[model samples]
Target: MKKIILSISFIFTFVICFAAIVADLTGTWKGLIKFGDQKLELTYKLKAEGEKLTGSIVSSYGEIPLTDGKIAGSDFSYKIDIGGGPQESKGKFMGDSIQITSTFGGNSVTNTFKRVAEK
Candidate 1:
């Protein structure tokens, strides 16, 4: 029926638009986290292929590989083990800002990331 066809078209369009928004996370993000006065600068570089995200974190320690990254809508979750134990992060995107909550070493730290400006 006409109504059914229209409904499917609308759903498809919405899904494509949402996927584009999720893909926008691909690139470099920089943020600083403070742990009791010890502040560290971190950079995240992400790549999107379909709903899977591949990226790495760069800090003073070096580059840390991100594992099992996946995205749905505007939310994403990934894991990495650095220094201590396995760290898990859940991130949400708002405009040009990314808010992430990372948990590791029995503590959780939340940081805001801004997209790196391109030359």
Candidate 2:
């Protein structure tokens, strides 16, 4: 069953690669969000262990904890309740940056965050 063995090997390799991508998401990122004419800067401190992602978002308002966070390959989703109920955010990791989009009250805001280097 050479074909069967090859198939299994391929599947195993893919899983390992996918896990690596998810694991690489641990770091700090910064971005700016615009609400009409006002722009607010935000920072994300993230930690990834397996498929679970735990992080906090720091903004001018305050720091908000990330909830129901999951990382699948290069994509992730997290929920945050910033006084106005819970809003779900979805994002994709791109090289040195990530693009996250969240919807609130039928309006969607997307922020592109660059990786923050550790000092």
Candidate 3:
């Protein structure tokens, strides 16, 4: 009986931790990507509701609404259409930072984003 109780407690703790990890993704994150010799800054304003994620990717060009966003544990994925085509990005949410890999035209680039503190 004691073993069973301990196991149940462990499972409950794991479930709560898993949920909180995903929930922590909400807020602003900033990163930079380089195109040849030029570097462009990217900002993400993310909101997570359960497994559904909604956000906007802002840059000097303009703000692009994120689509088809999903989150599970510390992993997330989202899509953006920039007229040329729909670009999909997959990332892992690390504490205080996130690493994202985006593919376009048969090329992939990975960028690391740091979480921005709210004012």
| Best by the TM-score measure | 3
For residues 51-89, what per-residue lDDT tens digits would candidate 3 score against the true structure? 999999999999999999999889999999989878999
Q: Rank the candidates by lDDT, best first.
A: 3, 2, 1
| Cα-based lDDT for every prediction | 0.88, 0.92, 0.94
Give the Å shift of residue 26 in candidate 3: 0.6
- Residue 12's C-alpha lDDT in candidate 3? 100
Worst 10 residues of 1 by lDDT: 79-88
Of the candidates numbered 1 and 3, which has the greater lDDT value?
Answer: 3
Model 1 per-residue lDDT at 77:
87
Query: What lDDT score goes with residue 111 in model 2?
Result: 87
lDDT of 2: 0.92
- Per-residue alpha-carbon lDDT of model 2 for 62-84, expressed as tens digits? 89999999988899999999788
Query: Which residue runs of candidate 3 sit more than 4 Å off their true CA positions?
Result: none
Model 2, residue pairs in steric clash: none
1 against 2, candidate with superior lDDT: 2
CA RMSD of all predictions: 1.4, 1.3, 1.2
